[model samples]
Every structure is written in structure tokens, then in C-alpha cells.
Target chain A: MKAVGEESASQELQRVVGAGRRADWVMASIGLAILIVAMGTLISVFADLIHSGWPRLTDPDFYTNFPSRRASDAGILSAWVGTSLVMLVTIVIVIPLGVAGGVYLEEYAPHNWISDFIEVNVSNLAGVPSIIYGLLALGLFVYTFGMGQTVLVAGLVLALLTLPVIIVATREAIRSIPQELREAAFALGADKWQTVRLYILPAARPGILTGAIVGLARAIGETAPVITIGALTFIAFLPPAPLQSDFPYLNFEWLNAPFTVMPIQMFNWVSRPQAEFQVNAAAAGVVLMIMTLAMNGLAIYVRFRLRGRVQ
Target chain B: MTSVDAVTEDPLLVRGRIQPSAEFLTHRRLADRLARVLLAAAAAVSVLVTTGIVYVLISESAGFFAHVPLKEFLTDTEWTPVFENARYGMLPLLAGTVTIAGIALLIAVPAGLALAVYLSEYAHVTVRETIKPLLELIEGVPTVVYGYFALLFVTPLLQRIIPGLPGFNMLSPGVVMGIAILPYTASLSEDAMRAVPKALREGGYALGFSRFRVATRVVIPAALSGISAAFVLGMSRAVGETMVVAIAAGQNANFTFNPLEGAATITAYIVQISMGDLPYGSIAYQSVFAVGLVLFIMTFLFNVAGFYLRRRFREVY
Candidate 1:
């Protein structure tokens, strides 16, 4: 009877071991499958982009001048400049507002329903689809504010779209700072404002900058919202300076000028019937991809550097 | 005699009674007041941006309702704003949006969950570090790149596999969108899974459970709320995707159930209309807002649902 009981116990152990091995195999297989799918998509995208864009890459004119009516003369210079100006303006507009809002929420604001409600809505706004921002821009900037399709209006709309992301990221960065640092400053007789300005701001700067850059990158890729604001599809001219062109110097006209962006230009190119234009679109994709990737890389580097320094 | 001498010496101290200067006090008060005012102004900006969005959407949508009846706009089958005679049907666009979102979720949820599981449960530290950055690389690729890929590669591949596939159809674009949002779902789900306490896993392991069993039965169940939130958010992103659908999925706003056929999403429709010259204040112009209102409502609902689910079912442990 003792021998039989021991035999049964060992058999049960074997059964459990068998089940465990089977589960491991299953999970490993699933993981392999997912990795394959993801890598396959990435590889194919690069392959296609190279295949389409390789032929036209040697064209010196591709990077030199603005697109013209003739297909052969078309380049992305104007669109690139326009995208840069709009992005720069968007960064300038969103960073201060977003950082301040984040500072208020994380460092100063009393914990209450009002702050909580704002936090909730801000998170919601982050998820509120980029196209909806376009609609908002159309109504507010174009019709109500009567700013028309100028670069300033486009920049403001993109700024609004990115505000929530910047705010959220900045809040996280600020919250991650050890409370002891703030307390230590306070113990040294530093006021709340002084502590935030001197110590907290410096400590949080890397993270805050990462968030702002990422938000700017997102705005750079955005096409739907800017398009809806009526950024000109075929602007051959450079965008006028915001202060000198639009406000008092230019009589505050809303419908004075038109604008275009890289994504919109690519869209226009892709929609055309010509195969060469499709190739140009792919090349533009490569450029836009590089720009966004550079920003993301910088952000990741900053985050890591900051984490190391803090440690 | 000593006490009398000390009292006489205190006369100098009595003559030296001093206070903080009035300018110093006023400057301090002014600084405090300025800080308060600045904070108030910042708070007001947040409120204004938020309220401004709702007001704009509502007002434009109200203009739309003035021209078209609510029932017809909601239930109509066709969406051709550029037609010689336009119909303001929003159903087709909504259906297209839902169809693509459904396909995208089908692709994203399972693969993303698997990636999350691998990273959280099975991957070595080095592997996790490498894979995490790779996943972020995927996330960082611009939507336009994905659009171009969908248009130039995926659609052609689909055409080869499935004969007579439209150059611009829902399936290719939807699949591309899934790839685009997969990192978001995976990263968030991985964070959620990691949040599940190590003690629970140890307890399961002590009971002789396998890592797979522990992960699936213990960790995943523990992080179900966050995983669900990630899934919902991914769906919202898929629905909101514009460039992919715009480039690969044609701007034919017909209410078709077939994935192989061209369909127009609400976003694609807005892009299509806005890119061209639709006369201002015409019915075609109002249709953009009408469609925008619908898109806004759908995304808002998803966002709210995702928020509540993440909050309500979030486990402290």
C-alpha cells in the first residue's frame, strides 16, 4: 500500500510538470508569432519605401525649390519650410501653457474637485482624435476668430491638439521628483515659488523638454487638422512672419494668405494620377519619418540621461 | 543696586524699537498678489480651451441641423457631398469608421497582449530593453509613412492575394492602422501587467504553477482593467486614424459591409471635402461640421468609457 501511494504521488508530479512544459511552449510560440508580425510589417514598410523612393533620390531639384504647376519642377522646399515654421510656432505656444498648467496641477494646486475635473478632462482631450481638433480650428480660428487659413491659425490649432499630451507628460515628470527635495528647500527658508523656480524646474527640465519635443513631433506629422484649417495645398510662396504679416502691420486680415505642410503636400502628390508623383510621396514619407524619429530619439536620450543623473 | 543699573541700561533698547520698512512689506504683498493673479490666469486658460472646444462643435453642428433634419442625417445611406445634388447621410461614414476600427482591434488586441505577456513575463532584462525601444521605434514612425506603406505595399499585396481588390479599401488601411497602434496597446498593457504585484506571482510559483499559468491566470486577470483600457484606447485611435484611411481607403462614402470595397470614414470625408473647394456656408460646408460632430461624439464616448473602466476597476495591489 505504501509503494502504491508513492507511485501515485510521483505520477501526479509528472503530470503537473508535463502541463507546465506544454504551457511554456504555447506561450513561446505566441511570442514568436507576435514578433514576426511586428517585424514583418516594419521590414516591408522600409522595403517598399526604398523601392519606390530610390530612383528619385538623386534628383537635386527634389530638395531645392517649391513645387510648381509643372510636375518636373515640383519640390518640397516650401512645404518643408512651412512645416518647420508651423511646428516652431506650435512648440512656442504649447510649451509655456502646458508646462505652467502641469506645474500648477502637480506642485501648487490644492487637491479638490476642480483640479480633479481638470485632470480628467485633460486626459480625455489627449484621446479626442486629431480630426476633431480640425473641426474646432475650422469653427474657432477660421469662422469665429476669422484668422482664415494662415500659418498662425494652423499653428494654434496644432498647439491645442498637442497641449494635453505636453501637460500630461510634464505632470508625470514633475510628480516623479522626490518630495524630499521640495521639503529640503522649504526647510532652508525658500518660498514655494522660489523652490519651484530654482530646484524643481531644473530637476524636471529634461523630462519636460522630452514631452514638449514629442508633442512637437506629433504636431509635425499631423495632416488632418491643418488641412481642415485650409492650409493651402499649393503655396509657392514662403509664409509671412506671424507678427509682421497678420496683426497690426498688415491690418489684421484673416484671409490674407494661404499655407501648406509636408503631410499635405505628400497627400497631394499621392492623390495625383502620375506614378512619379507617388514616388515623390514615398520620398517625402522618408523625410517626415526621419524628422519624427530624430525627435523621438532625442527625447529618449534626454530621458535616459536625466534618469542616470538623478540616480 | 544691580537691578537698578540694568533698568537704567534698558532705556537705550527702548529708544531702538524698529519695524520692517513699509516698502519691503508692500513689495512682498505685491509679489504675492502677482503670483495669485498669474495662477488665476493660467487656470482660466485651461477652462477657456476646454469650453471653447465644446462651444465651437455645438455651434457648428447646430448650423448643420438647421439645414438637414436629424433623422435623415442619422439614417441616410449615401454620403456624397460633392454630388450635383448632395445628400447629408452620416450613417455610411460612421459605419466605415466602425468597420475599420473593428478590424484594427481584431489585429491589435491579441498580438499586443501577446507582446505584453512576453515582455512582462518571459523576456530577459536585456531582451526587454531591446524590444521596448524597438516597439517605440514603431510608435515613432509617422502616420504618413504608414499611409504610404498601406497605399504602395499593403494594398498591392492584398490585390495579389485577393483578386479584384480595390486599390483603396478598408482591409489594408485597417491592418496598417492596427500595426500603427499596436505599440500603444502593448506598452500600456505591459505596464499594467508589471503593476501586478510580484508576491502574487511568487505565491503561484510556490504552488508549482508554470510561468505561463501564472501570467495568464494570475497576472493578466489581475491587470484586466488596464488591458481593457488599452484595448479601448487602441480602438479609439484606429477610429480616429486619418492619413492611412485617406490614402489607402478611397473617399467613396457608401455604406458597404464589404471590406474589399472602397469606403470613406468620417475623417477621410473631412479631409476629402476640406482639400477641395467646397463653397462656404453651403450644405457641403455644413456637412463637414455635421460629420465632425459625429466623429467627436464617438471618440468622446470611447474616451470617457476608457477613463471610467481604467479608474473604476483599477486594483490598488
Candidate 2:
């Protein structure tokens, strides 16, 4: 009778375990399906954009002409130029400031209320909607600084949106460097500056680059802040070329010139009731996505390499 | 270590300063002090950004409040700022925001958590490595691209199944926003789950639990604080998401929760007024700031709460 009871208990355990395995199979597949759905959406978007946007690409002028009322005449000249210029401006501002801020928090700042204040407020700033950044630029840059709605203002706004991302990323990278590396440098009588300059920055390079690339991608794709700063929705004209016809060939006037970006241009096109404009928007999207994917690929590669080494 | 110590103990070097010249040392000290000040200034920029955002939103919105009673902005149901008789009701936009954002969270939280479970618990290392970057690549995709996908692909597909679904319904954008935010949810949750020590899973297994039970009942509970952090961050993202909702969820400020209808969120409303030819200092222009202030506060609270949860419940190994 005791042996029979033991056998029945064994059977019960088998039954429960089998049920769990079945549940696991179901749950795991469900998880995979979710991933596939994500990939499916991405693949479908790529295919759809290419299918619709490919025809426009054959016309080299598609990359050269300014926005026109007629879809047949429209190209992305002003839009692309504005985007590149704004990115350049953003890069100049964000990298040094973001890296410095990150370094201070990670390596130098004390673990006190002031450091805590900066960290918490930075996260909060990161969470503020892109549009609110636009509002700040509007009030601060456009009105107070008297910059008007120019490329510089838009660039500044995007930089603010990306600063928190870079700071957090930099800190994470700096944190991952084993403490022993720093201790060794200190033991050799290296000052804090020498230790950071000689070892810390070099070690954190890959992580910092990954962060900058990701942040740059974000700044490129932003729309709301640029819009809030009152970037022209319709710009048939390009900003004056830095290489100008005048004696001072490097023009500074374009810094304050009104601008439009790729996403904003796409937005304006999509808003038009014309069926043709929809195709143009699709084409513009393909271009925008290509830029984003390129940046993302570089960042992913950097992170992948870093993980292999750092971990 | 001995070679370095022997060099340090050399009679001339041991007595001398670390650097060659006193002038150089003074210069170096000045540079170090300068560097610290610069770093501090750089760090302060973030604080300034927050203060600037708050100040700008409040100052502009205060003008809006002075024009329209605060009670009316809160209680009224209409949001027809551009109509012949402009009514400044905040609810319609909010209703639309809540509906799309709610739908987005509903879809994202479950799928993202399950995906996190798979990556952390079940998948092989190779599989995890291959899929992880691809998943995060979705996060890097521009919101505007998601917007177009929703409007162009998902909306048409949904309309085919739901016969009377509006062209610009909340459903399509809602789902697409979930897809857009999937990385944030899944990545955070995966990190949290992976943080649960191996011994805990072994403990569950030693008790005769299967991998599934070990993950769901034992592991997830251990990482609840982190998972909650993910949930809050996801909510914040859903609320602030602008492009997809603006493009696919219609420009009309509909005061309904039905997923089949077109509606405008606060972000969408900002897009609408900005696109129009609103003269500077116009009431409509200021109203967008008012709307933005609302969006700002909502996201701010969620983010701080999420941050606190992460700090509070983070399990140390």
C-alpha cells in the first residue's frame, strides 16, 4: 500500500511537470511571435517605403531641387541641407558638453545632494516632451536671445533633447571600467586629471562613441522641437552657402537663416490633400530611415564590440 | 610592482617633485581647477534646461489662464480653438491622449514583458545576442517613420478587418506606438530579470519547478521593482509620444474613448496650431503652451516615480 502511494505521487509530479513544459512552450512561442511581429512591422515598412519611393529616387533631381507646389517638381534640397547643417551644429554643441557633464558626475562629483540634484534633474529634463523643449527654445532663444527661428535655435533645442541621453550613457560607460584600473593609476601618484585623461577617457571611448552616435541619430530624427521653434514649414529657398560670392566667403548669415528639416518636410507633404504628395512623403521617409538605420548600425556595432571586451 | 617601487625610491627622484618644474606644476594645478569648473558648468546645463522648460511653459500658460478661467480649461469638454467661436476645453485632447496612450500601454506591457522573459530566461546566448540589437533598433527608428507606417500600412490593414473603422482611428496609431515603445519596455524588463541571481532560479528548480514556473512565479516576483520601473517608463513614453498619434490619430479633437474614431492628443494639438498661420502672441499660440504644460507635468511625475522605484527596489547581488 505504501509503495502504491509512492507510485501515484510520482505520476502526479510527472503530470504537473508536463503541464508546465506545455505552458513554457506556449509562452516561449508567444514571446517569439511578439519579436517576429516587431521585425515584421520593420520589414513591411522598409518594403512599403521602397516600393512607393523607388521611382522618385531614379530622378537625381529628387535629391537636388527645392520643395515645389507640384509633386513632379519637388525635390528635397532645402530639407536635406537644413537637416545636415542642423546636425553639424548639434554635434558641435552636444559632444563636449555632454561628455564633460557625464565625466564630472561619474569621476569627480561628490556623492552628495548637489550631485544628486544634477542627476535627478537631468533625468527629468530627459523625460520632458520634445515639444516642451521647442517651447523653451521659442521663449528663450527666439525671443530673449533674439536668434529668431533659425538653424541655430533648432540645433540648440535638439541638443538639449539629446544631452541627458549622452550624460547617462557616458556615466554608464565610465562606471563599467573596473575600479582597479583607476586604483593602479592613483597608486602611481597620478593626479585625478592625469588618471582621467590617461586612462578613464581612453577606456570609455567606445561607450562614449556609442552614446554620441545614438544621441546624434535622435537629434536628426526630431520634429517637435524644431516645429515649436517655428522653423518654416515651406522653404523654397536654401540658406546662403558658407562658400559665398563675397570677400568673406565663409558666411555667418546662414546661422540665423530660416530652415526646414527632413521630418518636418515629410510632415508638410503628408498634410497636403494631393495623392502625389503622399508618394513624395514616402520617398522622403525612405531617405530619413536610411540615415537613421546607418547611425543605428554604427552604434550597435560599437556596443557589440564594447560588450565583448568590457564584459 | 617592485620595479615601480624601486624607481620611486631612487635618491634624486624620491626627493624631487612629481613634475619637472614648479611653473609646470602651477600651470597643471590651474588647468585642473579650470577643468573642474568647466565640468561643473556643463553639468549645470541640464538643471538649467529643466528650469527653462518649466519657466517657459508656466509663463506662457499663465497668460492663457489669465484669459480663460482655470476651471473652464479643466472642466469644459470642448477643444475647438480654431473654430469660429473658439472654445478652450482641454478634455477632448486629453480624452484622445488617454485613449491612444492607454491602448498603447495595454499592448506593450504584456508583450514586452514576455519578450523580456524569453531573452533573459529561455533563449540561448547566441539567440539573445542576435535578437537584442534588432529589438533595440526599433527604438532608434524615428517616431515619424512609425507615424507613416501606421497611416499607410496598419490603418489600411485594420480597415479591411473592421468594416466601419475610420481612416484615422486611434487603434492603428495605438498599436504602432506600442511597437515603437517595445524596446524601452522589453530592454528594461530584460535587464531587471537578468539581474535576479542565478541561485534564486536554482532554488525554484530544486523545489521541482519547471523553467516556466521558475521564471513567472520565482524570478519575476524577485524583480518586481525593476519591472514596475519599466512599466512606469513605458507609460511615460506612451504619453509623450507625438509623431505617430499626430499623423495617424487625426487632427480633430474628438472627445471619445472609442478606438475606432479619430482624435487629437495634446502633442497633436500642438502640431496642429503650429502648422496653422497663428500670429505670434495669439491666444491659440499660447494655448499650445497650456496644453504642453499638462503633458510636461504628466510625464515628469511618471519619470520621477519610475526613477525612485529603480533606486528603491534594485537588488544587489
Candidate 3:
């Protein structure tokens, strides 16, 4: 009777194991299907954009001409130029501010309420909708500071939107450095500034770059805040040239010039009732998508290299 | 000889005083102090941003409230601020926002959790590495493109399945938004699950548990706090999303929970009012700020809650 009970127990264990293996297989299959669906959506979105936008995408003039009444005549010259200038201004503002903010939080901040308040503030700002930032710019920059709806205002808004990203990235990168490196520098009679400038910043370069690029990539595609700031949807004129042919070769007039960006251009086209305009929207999208994806791809590559080195 | 020894042993003797000039030391110290102040100022900018957002929203909304009573703003169902006979009710927009966000969360939470589990527990390192970046690429796609896709692609497909479905409906945008936020939720959840110690999984295995059981029963429970954080953050993102809902969902402010219907969210309303030719400081213009205040409060609460969850249940292994 005792031997019979042992045999039944063994049979039960085998049955359970068999069922568990089948369950694992089922879960794996479901997970694979989910991943494939996600990737398939991405590819299809790209293919659809390319297919619809092929005419404008292939045309050389499509990149050069200003917006026109005729769909075929319309190009993204003013839009692209405006986007580049705004991005240039954004880069100038965001890099130093984001990197410094990140360094202070990670290295200099004492364990106190002030640092905690800043930490909470940064995360909260990250969650605020892009449109709210536009409202802020409308009230603060346009009205109070009298920056108007210019390239500088757009840069300022995007810089603020992207700041938290860089700060978080910098902190994470800094955190990953071994504590022993800082200790060793201290032991060698090096001050905090020397250690940070020489050792910490160099080691964290890849991660910080990745963050900055990612932030810029996000900013480039943003639409709502720019719209809120009242960016003109139809801009036939470009901002004044930053470089001039006369004395005082640099011109500051463009900073105050009104501008439009790629995504806003796309928004204007997509909203048009005409089918031809929709085609133009698709083409514009293809251009915008390429830029953001390339930036993101570069960031990922940098991060991968950083991970490899650390490991 | 004794006098010379006494001079050499003086604590304040000129030991290396010539090697490093006092002036140079002061300069270096000044530079260091300057760097710290600049860095702190940079950090302070974030606080200022939050302050600016609050100040703008409240100040403008106060202008709105002085004209439209708070009760009417809350209880009234119609939202026709742009009309000649303007109505200040915000419930319809709020309902639409909640409906779309609810739909989005329903789809994103499950799929995201499953993706996280697969990445953290089942996939090989090479597979995970390749797939993770590709998944993140979904996020890199702009909301405007997703909006385009919702209007042009997904809506058409859905219309064929359900005849008489409106061209602009909440269902299509909500679905696309789910896909858009999936990477964010999945990546965060994966990090949380990965943080669960290996020893726990080993213990489950030693108890005759299979990998599936070990992951679901052991790892997931251990990482529950982190997974909740991901869920809340994703929810916050879904609520704040603007362009997709604005383009795909109709511009009409519909007050209903049915995903099949078209509606405008608070964000879509802001886009609508601001895009139109509203005079500065007009009632309609100030209404955007009022609506923005609502959006801000919703997202703020969710973010603070997520932050609290992350800190409160942070498992120190």
C-alpha cells in the first residue's frame, strides 16, 4: 500500500511538470506575438508614409520652395530653415543649463530639503503637458518679457521641456561611476573641481550626449507648445541670415523673427481638407521622422557603447 | 645648530609657500566657488519652471473665473466658449479626456506588463538588447505622425469592421495612443522586474516551480511597487497626450464614455481655441488657461502619487 502511494505521487509530479512546460510555451508564444505586432506597426507606419509621400520626397524642389497655394508648388523651405535656427538656439541654451543642473544635483547637493524640492520639481515638470509650457511662454515670454512669438521664445520653451531629460541622464551617468575614483582623487590631493572636470565628466560624456540628443530629438517633433506660442503656420519668408555680407558679419535680427517648424507645418497640412495637402503632410512627416530617428539611433549607439565599456 | 633646528621645525615655516603662490590658491578657490554657484543656479531653473507654470495657469484662470462662476464651469455640460452665445461648461471635455485615457490604459497596461515580463524573465541577453531599442523606437515616433496614422490608417481599418463608425472616433486614437505609450510602461516595468534579486527566482526553482510560475508568482510580486509606478506614469502620459486625440478624435466636445463616439479632450480644446483667432485676454482665450489649469492639476497629482509610490516601496536589496 505504501509503495502504491509513492507511485501515485510520482505520477502527479510528472503531470504538473508537463502542464508547466506547456504553459511556459504558451506564454512565450504570446509574448513573441506582442513584440511582432509592435515592430510591425512601426514598419507599416514608415512604409505608409513613404508610399504616400513618394512624389514630394523624390522632388528636389520639395525641399527648397516656400509654402504655396498650389499643393504641388508648396515646399518646406521656410519651415526647415526656421526649425534649424530654433534648434540652434535651443542647443545653446539647453546644453550648459541641463549639464550643470545635473552635476549640481549629483555631486554638490547635500541631503536636505532644498535638493529634495528640486528633485521633486524636476520630475513634476517632466509630467506637465507640452501645451502648458506653451501657455507659460505665451504669458511670460510673449507678454511679460516681450520676446514675442519668435525663434528665441520657441528655443526657450523647448529648452525648458528638454532640461529635465538631460538632468536625469547626467545624474544617472554620474551615479554609475565608481566611488573609488573620487576617493582616489581626494587621496591624491585633488580638489572636487579637478576630479569632476578631469575624470567624472570625461567618463560620463557618452551618457550625457545620449541624453542631450534624445532631448533635442523630442523637442524637434513637438507641436502643441509651439502652436500655443502662436507660431505662424504659413511662413513665406525666412528669418534674417545669421551671417551677413557686410561689416559686423553676425546678425541678431533673426532671434526676433517669427518662425514655423516641421511638425507645425505637418499639422497645418494634415488638417487641410484637400487630399493633395495630405500628401504633402506625409512627405513632411517622412523628413521629420528621419531626423528624430537618426538622432535616437545615435543616442542608442552611444549608450550601447557606454554599456559595453562599463561591463 | 639648536636655533636653526627650532626655525626649521616652526609650524608656520615657509614649507611649499613658494611652490604654490597664495594668489593662485585664492584664484582656484574662487573658480571652484563660482562653479558651484552656477551649477546650483542651473538646478534652480527647474523650480522656476514649475513656478511659472503655476503662476501662469492660476493668474489667467482667475481672470476666467471672475467672468464664469466655478459652479457653472464644473456642472455645466456644454463647452462652447468660441460661440457667439458662449458656454463655459468643461464636463464634456473632461469626460472625453477620461474616456480616451481609460481606453488607452486598458490596452497599454496588460501588453506592457507582458512585454516587460518577457524581456526580464524569458529572453536571452542578445534578444532583449536588440528588441528593447527597437521597442523604444516606437516612442521616438512623433505624436503628430501617430495622429496622422490614427486619422488615415487605423480609422479606415476600424470603419470597415464596424460599419457606420464615424471617421473621427475615440477608439482609433486611444488604440494608437496605447501603442505609443507601451514602450514607456514596458521599459519601466522591465527595469523594476530586473531589479528583483536572482536568489528569489532560484528559490522558486528549487521548489519545483517552472520559469513561468517563478516569474509570475515570485518576481512579479517582488516588483509590484515598481510596476505600479510604471502604471501610474503611463496613465499620466496618456492623459496629457494632445496631438493624436486632437487629429483623430473629432473636434466636437462629446460627453460620453462610449469609445465608438467622437470627442474633444482638454488638450484638443486648448489646441482648437489657441489656433483660432482669439483676441488676447478675451474670455475664450483665457478659457484655454482655465482648461490648462485642469490638465495641470490632474497630471500633477498623478506625478506626485507615482513619486510617492517609488519612494515608499523602494526595495533595497
Give the Cα lDDT of each candidate: 0.81, 0.87, 0.89
Error of 1 at B281 (Å): 1.1
- lDDT digits (tens) for residues A1-311 of candidate 3: 68667778878888899999998888888788889888898998899999999999999899999998999999999999998999999999999999999999999999999999999888888888888899999989998788889999999999999999999999988998889877866765456776677667877788899889988999999999999999999999999999999999999999999999999999999999899999999999999999999999999998887774642
- Clashing pairs for predicted structure model 1, backbone only: A232-A259
**Fnat of candidate 3:** 0.71
Most accurate candidate by DockQ: 2
TM-score of predicted chain B, candidate 3: 0.93
DockQ of candidate 3 (2 decimals): 0.52
Model 3 segments beyond 4 Å from truth? A1-7, A308-311, B1-19, B313-315
Evaluated with lDDT, which candidate comes out highest?
3
The local distance difference test score of model 3 is 0.89
Cα lDDT tens digits for candidate 2, B1-317: 22335434534343566654566556657878888999989999999888898898898888889998988899899998778898998999999999999999898999899999999989999999899888877888888888888998899999899998888999999999998898889998998898888999999989988889999998899889889999998998899898899899999988999999999999999988877778777788899889999999999999998888777666355
What is the C-alpha lDDT profile of model 3 across B1-317, one tens digit per residue? 12224323435344655444566557657878988899999999999999999999999889999999999999999999988899999999999999999988888899999989889989999999999889878998989999999999999999999999998899999999998999989998898888888999999999999889998999999988888988998988999999999999989988888899999999999998878888998999999999999999999998888877676556466
How well does candidate 3 score on lDDT at residue A189?
49
Error of 3 at A100 (Å): 0.3
Taking the candidates in order, what DockQ does each have? 0.41, 0.58, 0.52
For the predicted complex of model 1, DockQ is: 0.41
Clash-forming residue pairs, model 2: none
Shift of residue A258 alpha carbon in model 1, Å: 2.5
